[model samples]
Target chain A: MVFRELSLPVRLLFYLFLIVAAVSILYPLTWMSYTSLKTNEEVMLSPFGLPTRVSFENIAEAWQTGNFTRLYANSLLIAIVSVVGIITISTTAAYGLARYHFNGNRALFLYFLVGMAVPTQALMVPSFKLMAILDSWAAALHLPVPLLNSPLAVILTYMSWSSLAIIFIRAYFMSIPPELEDAARVDGARELQILRHVMVPLAMPAIATMTIFYFVFFWNDFLWPLIYLHKHTLRTIPLGIMHFEGKYVSLWSLQVAALSLAAWPPIFIYVLFHRRIQRGLTEGALKF
Target chain B: MANTSQAGAAIPRMRPSRFRLPPGEAWRENLYGYLFISPWILGFVMFLAGPLLVSLGLMFTEYAGFKKITYVGLANFEELIKFDIRFIGSLRVSAVFAFWTVSLAIIISLAMALLLNQRFKGHTFFRGLFYLPAAVSGVAMTFVWAAMFEKDYGMFNQILRIFDFDRVAWLTSIEWALPSYIIMRLYGVGHYMVIMLAGLQSIPDDLHEAAKVDGANALALFRHVTLPLLSPTIFFLMIVGMIGSLQVFTEGFMLTQGGPARSTLFYVLYLYIVAFTERRFGYASVLAWLLFLIIMGLTLLQFWLARRWVHYESEEA
Candidate 1:
């Protein structure tokens, strides 16, 4: 692994390229942050200029008028519930595939893989119809709760898309040496006990990474939420941003402000989990 | 835990106690597997498979979503191919858009990955910063970019004005609308850069050292060694990128509404309009099938080409 040191010219070129790439990547976000604090008049008069008065008025207004409090709550509930559901079902299924020599296991695994390749566009129309049928069925059964346009609908849809998570977890589980599980079983541990006490804890890092990835995917999802949720109160962040833009067409400052608010949470989470996310993708699963 | 353990021992020891299931127990294990995956299976049969079949059937009919579907075999395809001028134009627009977007995204992201792979101060912070756009929703980013590209009182135009250039009509002008959307899409390089960085890191340092010892310069090393080794990852990213770009909708929907003169009328947006807005479900189905075919063909082509260029070290062994 010995290497020759780079010439001064090459080193300089490398740094120069890094600086340009860094600036280009960060410029739009920094500009958005700065523009969010400016007044409308200032925004129009000097769009790129430093704000004459830095104020929290736009942020306050966006929070209040954009209905983001409700949107945030809805998004959080959906993401959390879906993540829990995905982790539970996928972990069990992945463990079954990894540890058990059951009939049709290979066929079922291939089935799930095919599910990954099928585009959602092919399913959107039918899924909407199914939801309609379910809504009617709920009415006919005199169900106490409304099902359509609820966070529950979004959660169910999110669960349907958990095949990728299942595959990743299954791959991760396969990489774990069977000796650990054998050690547990030798102590007279049952299957569920071995899974709970041994395998789950050993796979915690991969699980944590999957949880974050699922959360980000669910939180940033727009198309499903837009299709299923028709009620104004049930709008998620992306749909809420669309509504805010339609209502406040002329005010770029407020739009930028609201947009920043909507985008910040997931970006912040990515910053905190960047290394884990990278490690999970490259070194954890899909390596072989 | 002790009480549960005692209760567990009190129960008769189940047959086939080992992890391996016996032939008789196989049915029960499979039942449990199906039960575990029941939600996804139910979802697939009811939601995904049903719609796909219905859409395929609908393509041969004239169903405006509200009315009873009347059979009109191949008419929708006929109209799209022969009569509709905008259909072909929109296809061209989408093809061009997908081509440039994927190519530019690959180049920029690879460059970024190369840069990020180098040891630098605040490397972690920069890596996170680069991934910011992907973590954020497309709709929110589109709104921000729309604001930035506003022809009047927009930051971009303002900058151009400062440089003594004409104020460009970013979204409204037919000539500039697609380019505006393309520029807006440049932020998406972050997603692919992370993937590419992962691939770059996986390349062993010994390979580079060997190249250096052979007096191979950076350019030569990259061309002969790095590029060949990186081809498989690049191939994966390109396929994903192409499939994704072909279905570009949110930006066109939110930012340009398929445009000043259908300049930004993307394929998926057109299909969406046909299905939802016009109630032309049959026509939309045909369009959807066409897209599927195109994607499948392209993917197969990529796989075939991969055999020629992709260097898998293990394969030689």
Candidate 2:
């Protein structure tokens, strides 16, 4: 704990190591940001130099040419809807598991835990087929439901993979003292009322953490969108970036701008809420 | 919270006032639990389990997604074992990638965690900067990394030119491509570092103090005190890391397309090509099962080895 005791050479070495690690980690992002602002000629002539002209033209071009505005909106809608659904459904389920000692409770908990290890890739082919079947079934029944290639498909897929969040929340819930619930029960509060008023308030930190994690995952997801959302209009930012690359072959500046834009939201969120993310992930990983 | 009282009251009214529930109440509670988990369960059975079974069954056939699934018995497995040239090659490449990446990742992250455990200036900012990659979309970062590794005008080549070295074909050459992907992937060390730091923080300072009083130097103290306690975290990282690395797809798919003589053709990418592009659903299923078995076996082996090396202070040594 006493850093003053360390020798000068050792301290210098430690500082040098820290500098190298920081540069290695941050340089790519810095480079990307720099290149995004530069013109094509500038990028070709001096890859590492400051942009001679700091123009938002590449940003403007990437936004319009890559349909990034639409992609951003689509990604936002999917992430918000999915997080809402996951938090509501999983909180209720975790409440039941944490508060009630029912038959098959342990077995049911294990069943959900098993889903954690079931790789999404393993389920992709089947999920695809099921979506197709649902589309046909809805059509046959004359049910005016828009499911496939819609935001709904992406949301549902996201929900299926979000059981890990539920388990983490439930474990945290279990650690809460039973005295609070007993007091609520003595006040003749209904189960739903207790959940809404007491448990939810107490678990706000965990719930906030889950929301951020789920948002990042949903926002960054590529494979599910690639497989399910065939329409260009429904593509998320990740898929949109890929499509941009495919359409514009040599537009490196615009592509870098688009890539930076697509990657910025999550990076910004991480920077702002870095402590919460660390706490959440550490608590979940270590305890559970 | 109020549900506890309702449950408590409903239990006695429906049956005798005992700790255990009556048969009917038990059934009702079970039904409620099932109802609560219905969405995930239904999704699992319909989307995950059903397809998994179908894929398993398909392993014995020649189903190509569109054609009749002609029963081929063990022919796909047979070919994979004895005949397919790329099959074993991809496995070797995947094994090498998984082994090196996981080992290096563990070493680097643990080092970072140790450093971060010491109080430092701008520690939080550094932590955030490192972990930013975890939140960033892999596909988008890969795009940025692709440009960074571009042979002609890439920043990496420009740096190499400082040393008078020729430009390297990072993504095009079979020799350097896989290593490049590994390096690109290594930038996400922030996630692992945070986890390891958590584990390190949980260690009691008293233990280190005791070791120091016994004249133990830093290396000896770390060896005797730190690593033994950190083994469980290390073990968790190894298993998850290996499983993740084996299923590597995005980087290979985006950057290399498993090219340059298929040196970068990872096992999962090869299986994806077989299943989707070639329409060889049956063969793909066989490959999937093989992967499942290998992963399960390796995990079991890790657990077995952990019995010898992984020390838990809470458990009897």
Candidate 3:
């Protein structure tokens, strides 16, 4: 619709720019995927050429050697737990702020807003110390695993960093009319029931947005995982890929395969819900 | 924009006023409210506010992880400013990276957003294709870029070789190392573009019709109409992008490790090295605080400057 207003030359220029942008982004990813199928000799000898014969050997080898199964398991575990934790925690808070006229509601909302600006790096050192203390507490309780090197550490960290999520869901909840709740109240539904039946279902779009965003964040996050997860078994995909890169420094095909392994899961998610992801990100960003 | 209202304003007219509630009813409502929000409050206190205070306290002390803590009155800051040339270098690297990346991302992403916003063929496909890289793991994307930036037989060098140009030492050279990272990082600007695209689509068509009826050209339409409308999104991207770039770690950490004379020693990377590798927790805390302060200052500055250029629709009478 907007393009119809532009002159022919300007329209042509815009198309040119779009095509270039698309190619610039796509070419690299294509190269990485195809190169993952090539042998090291093939990669070195014909840098621009396609693989002599398409093969999954490099991917299999990298997956086995890189312990990617464990990495995928770990990453998926963290992402699921973190997204669920963040969404539930934030949505509940947002519902409270949006629905209630209680004392300190605004103050608590502002507190979360302020937390959003505090960089994660600022809290790293103390977080490590706090986790150590928590680890000792867990040990005293005879828990099976330590929080420091386990997925639980990152999950707990992820749950706490949902200020944006709170603000977002609150904005979402406020847009929801009070009549729905009032009607539910008139029907003798409890507050929690009203929330579960009315509010949550109404806010599924926003929740899904938060879920996708937080899932992507947890999956791709490098810094916290690097700091918290020291054990090889606990490594997530990004950390695992970095470790794989270090160990197989000279194996080009294996490295590409490993990188591809790390990239594919999130890419698959994006492809499936590209429209929702795009719309949600923009809406969420504007809210922020 | 609708959600920017305060708590009282956000409350619906159907709800009874706070003063009208009976004591028992008010108490019950408060109980329910607190019960609902307890999760976030708990999280904030446990994971954020508590650690923040601890970090602030640690900033004023000298202690390794295993050693007894001792008071150090701004000694870490003193050393950072008065000595520690590498600290200065890291700040410079971070500043340059932030400056270039934030500006370049704004320009490129906005342009792409505008282009994708047009009713063209394959626009949705293009939008997703562009934004696809932003969805990939940063470590993985960095590896692909690292391969492409390899000195010999890399994709970039092969193209250059075909064109009879000399192979550029993309990652190894001190000058190129930072820019290469910037280039690699720009691949993920698709998120910002999508945000901008949404901003563009939200712009009312009648407003453009009015502008065009007044004999405005394309440049004038963009300058007088589109830019002011999009300024809020631009301002947002600027602040968030700057904050992100200033605290950049993964690219430098994964690829360079702050090598080639620490040319790409991002501020966070250096702080990580200091705290984790060198066991200078106290000094690293100081570095972290300074970065926090710097980011806070820059963010405030952007807000101040945004008052001049960031036009919100709500401001219209």
TM-score top scorer: 3
Backbone clash pairs for candidate 1 read none
Off by over 4 Å in 1: A1-4, A7-13, A39-45, A52-54, A186-188, A283-288, B1-32, B296-317
* Cα lDDT tens digits for candidate 2, B1-317: 12222556443121111245555556655555555566656655665667677777878888765536699989998998889888888898899898888889999999998887777667777777677776674788888888889898787898899999999999999889989988877778778888888888889999999999999999998999999999878887888788878978878887787998999999988887887788787788888878867776665655556566555332242
* lDDT for each residue of candidate 3 in A1-288, tens digit (9 for 90 to 100): 367877999888887877876787898888888988888789778866788888888999999999988999999999998898889898888888877767777677765677777788877888888898899898999987688787888888889998888877777887777778877766778878888999999999889888988898888999999889999999999999988899888887888899889888888889998888888887776654
Q: What is the C-alpha DockQ of each candidate? A: 0.38, 0.42, 0.59
The true-versus-predicted C-alpha distance at residue A58 of model 3, in Å, is 0.9
Off by over 4 Å in 3: A1-17, A39-41, A143-145, B1-20, B298-317
Rank list by DockQ: 3, 2, 1
Write one digit per residue (lDDT tens) for candidate 1, span A175-246.
677767666656778677877899889888878889999998888778789778999999999889999999
lDDT of candidate 1 over B9-28, digit per residue (tens): 32222221234433555565
Least well predicted 10-residue stretch by lDDT in candidate 3 chain B: B1-10
lDDT tens digits, residue span B1-317, model 3: 22312233222222423343444455656877899999888988999889888888887788788748999988987898799998989999999999999999999998888777778888888888988988884889888898889888678888889999998999899989999989887888997899889888889999999999999998999999999998888888988899989888988898889988899999999999999999778888888888878787766666566566545432221
Docking class of 1: acceptable
Question: Sort by TM-score, best first: what order?
Answer: 3, 2, 1
Tell how far residue B203 is off in model 2, in angstroms.
Answer: 1.4
Off by over 4 Å in 2: B1-19, B22-28, B67-69, B295-317
What lDDT score belongs to each candidate, Candidate 1 first? 0.75, 0.77, 0.83
